[model samples]
Target: MSNVTRYLCAAAYLDSGFRDKVLAELLFDQFRAIPPSYGGFDLMPVIYHCRRSRMMLVVRDALITGFFVIGCFMAPLSTFGWLWTLVPFALLTVDGIRRGPLIVRALIWFWACYSVFSLIFLAIMTALIPAAAYLFASGLPFSGLYGSGSTGSVLQQFLIPVVTLGIALVYRIAIYLTLVGSLKPGAPEPIIATTHPRLARRLDYIRRAQWGNVTMYANEDAFMGAGRIQRNWSIAVELDRVRESHKPSRRADPVDIDPVELHAFVRGRLIEMRDRVLRPNEGIQRLDIGDHVVTRGIFTVADGQRDRAAGAHPMIDRNGLPRFQATAEEIAAIARHPQGGVRYYQRVTINNAGQEIRDLDGNLVAPAEDQEALTSAFIYLAVEGRMLYTQFVVTVLPPAHDHYHVVDSLPTMTSGRVTWEALKVLKLQLLRDVLAAPVRVVRTAVESVRQSAMTPNPRDHIVYPYGARLSVRELGASESLQTHIQVLDVGKYIKMIEQRLTEAVLDFLEERKVETGAYRMQAAGITVSAGNGGTVNVPMAFGEHASATVNGLRPGT
Candidate 1:
């Protein structure tokens, strides 16, 4: 398995709920759109792994059931008939008892241990009491009850199986511990590919299909997981003609500049920042203009076609994938409109080295020296109601959690070591594989059935707001900046992007013959406040909720 796949699998193994969510939302929810993952991580391999694990559970269940049936039949003919019957029941009882509330499970385990101790105590006293009586008295007191064919004989018969079962249980536990110890990340890649090449190919196909699509759901903040908001401020300056004192009549004339043209100019300037970078690896990795549209939910084919005909087309392509771009006219219209549902943004993505890069097939494309981190700045420009509006929201996408990176440091095992470890675990694992099979079978079946039943044509039902709201990359990302360098980089990129954005807006205003006094003052204040680590709050004309403020410190600090 690739590093990315290993991290994903380790994540799944560590967190069952996250694993189930990935399967349910991404793999099983056929109708829901799968969101595009940013920060150079592929989510498809994780989906494939979860699916494969589920299948393995089914196979394990089948083997266990087969063994159980054979044991039941052999119980009548074998000398260890009682053992066969007791083993399965013992496994089931133990498995069932382990689950439920934590406190209850603990109490149950305590009671079981206490009961076993009591039985051992009684057995020792029965033998010792009879021996003492024989030594003290001529005829053994209670000899009939304690003799070989009576209590003593019964105790021996009972204790023999109990002791044997205890030893077997200990051996089984050792096997389990060995199996767990042998479980290093990336160990399952070869087995998965060797066992299921066709499934692996299918996953690749799915990954390619969904790679670029921006899966959106209601109320999903597209900016979420891009990292903490490092800077959020907007400037709206009135579009007033520069007063020519000698030719005052020109002031009455409206400023003649199209919002589309202005937006294009700003976008070009931002894109040019990439070309100006002196260091390729240290500079922006991605720079482009993208339209981010928030809608009620995904459109059905009929709804999509109708919207297309009506000229208010949905922001999805024919294949039902998000088209993160709109026509110039559409952008101008949305910008001019007072409501805030859609906007065009110039996104700058700066990827720091020391992060694993993987291909669509989960193959390693780039190796890492250290943890990977991404810093992105989104700049939105709009001209509305004879005022120029410019906004910047900078975010940091931190590296994946350290636990996920454990795969990179896994010990290298020689073929002999691998074989020996497997052999050591094989016997006990086989027993457990059969004994715990029923529980696995039932759990897997219930989950499979639940997912299948829940799958529905979203259009057929009344539209509910709730839908799959998950991003695997975001889910896997570390909660905060991993290192001091990441913090420094985030601040550096934010400043660079902000500087470019400020220059672009100023140049646009100057070319349009708009007065720049107010804009320059606001920009100066923002820059100074941000530099001094003071909060900079901008009054948003749109509404109170639209207003944003930035704390003085660098993001992820």
Candidate 2:
């Protein structure tokens, strides 16, 4: 047996009362932790890379198109007649190429049709003009048709320019139609949340795993230190209950069900999950499967034993036995049975190597299995509110697999869970240095050094690039002074995660064939609305019902 197995077995044999606890602590202490990572650090880097790659492609096409257009314009700008007519064709091709593939194909078809029709039109004009001139010169024309022989030649010359203009107009119309059609959104590549394929695949696996009854808790005091008097913000989420509420009913459509409740439910879970995953014991465990490494978190009992006292539902395996160890009697009975506890434990296994041991009555005794677990579902929560927005900006190298939950952005293993808090943290960290650099430099010059000529004026403009060069006059001298008082931009992250989470939840519902309808899905956080009189956006029931006047005026009125 492996060293880990031997150690676990030895520990289990020491004392049954503290056996599981001791083993878990040993595993947790020895195993590494994987700090969470996203998009090879965070999403911004990946986005920047994608944008750079796509822009490079566009630049390549633009250069080629520009050269083609210039070549076509050469003749038109100089000779300025029949051959100059090809300028529109060149312009259309260039426009198509710049707009991307869909428009390019449209422009190609337009060119093909224009080529055929323009040739036919020119051919007919060529024959008709000359024939008409010949008839007029032969003196068979009436007075109005041709006053003199030279008149026919002048009229024939006018037809060529007119034909060129008509063809150009037709080509323009075709190109315009194609451009309009291509203006709509194209089939975009799927939003890749991460570049790690193994992580992504594990997310899918967890999504399919039994998570209905899986409950997750928060790591209380993760933000605020412990032993401080705080409001009862502790919140808990029973995913099974939340999911069961959405089950199909003969009386109602799933869409009609106020999605606000669903969003609220999920938002709480997401917040708790984030807090859990960021902490020491509540995070994920690294599991090595074949050649790939993935994260897996057990959301019930951290140990193999089920928490029956917590009302955890029993899990039944494929072998028609309880998935977890429930009672000692049941295990003893299974041991004495013919199957011999083959499917009794999910995490434990004892290899007897064909050596049979007999009990006091000469009954065959099954070998005991000692399970080595490095993951836990025991969470620490102490908040009743959903996470609206938190702005934490810290950038550090991702830790090893034994140090933290490395593969997952969110700590929970359940599919479709939100990582809004983590996302906000990443985004804040990415922009932190860039946003604070100027302030820091100015502060250091003015406050820290006390000798520099650097003076920040509120009226001064801060230049930032947007498309081309654009300047915003929003910089202030005392901006750095108020940096500590800055409010978190939680609404943006909340809205973003809410949208993604809503889609995911709806997709899951659709697969279950639930009837859906358009419903208001609001983010459960501090909501700010336009034109409010200090309106707090929590549940309306949390209103300030008690009022008192300390002075002549009502306090908190």
Specify the highest-TM-score model's number: 1
Local distance difference test, per candidate?
Answer: 0.56, 0.29
Tens digit of per-residue lDDT, candidate 2, span 1-557: 23122222222222222333322221222111111111111222222223333333234334433433443454222213333344334444454454767766676657646754664455446445655676768866444344454455444444434443433233333322322221112211223365767445433332222111211112221111011111111122211122336663443322222223333444454444334466433321221111011112212322222233342223332221122223544433332332321221111011111233467796878753212111111112111121121111111111112211122222232322223332332332222222232344454345435422432221132221101010000000112112111212122222333354445454544544443332112223223343553433332122368322111112222
TM values, all candidates: 0.65, 0.18
List ranges where model 1 is wrong by over 4 Å. 1-6, 61-109, 115-215, 241-254, 277-313, 316-341, 354-370, 411-440, 462-468, 527-557
State the lDDT at 8 in candidate 2: 21
RMSD of each candidate relative to the true structure? 9.5, 28.8
lDDT of 1 by residue, 509-535 (tens): 776567787777667657544355644
Model 1 steric clash total: 2
Please give the range of 10 consecutive residues that has the lowest summed lDDT in model 1: 74-83
Off by over 4 Å in 2: 1-51, 73-116, 119-557
lDDT of candidate 2 at residue 295, scale 0 to 100:
16
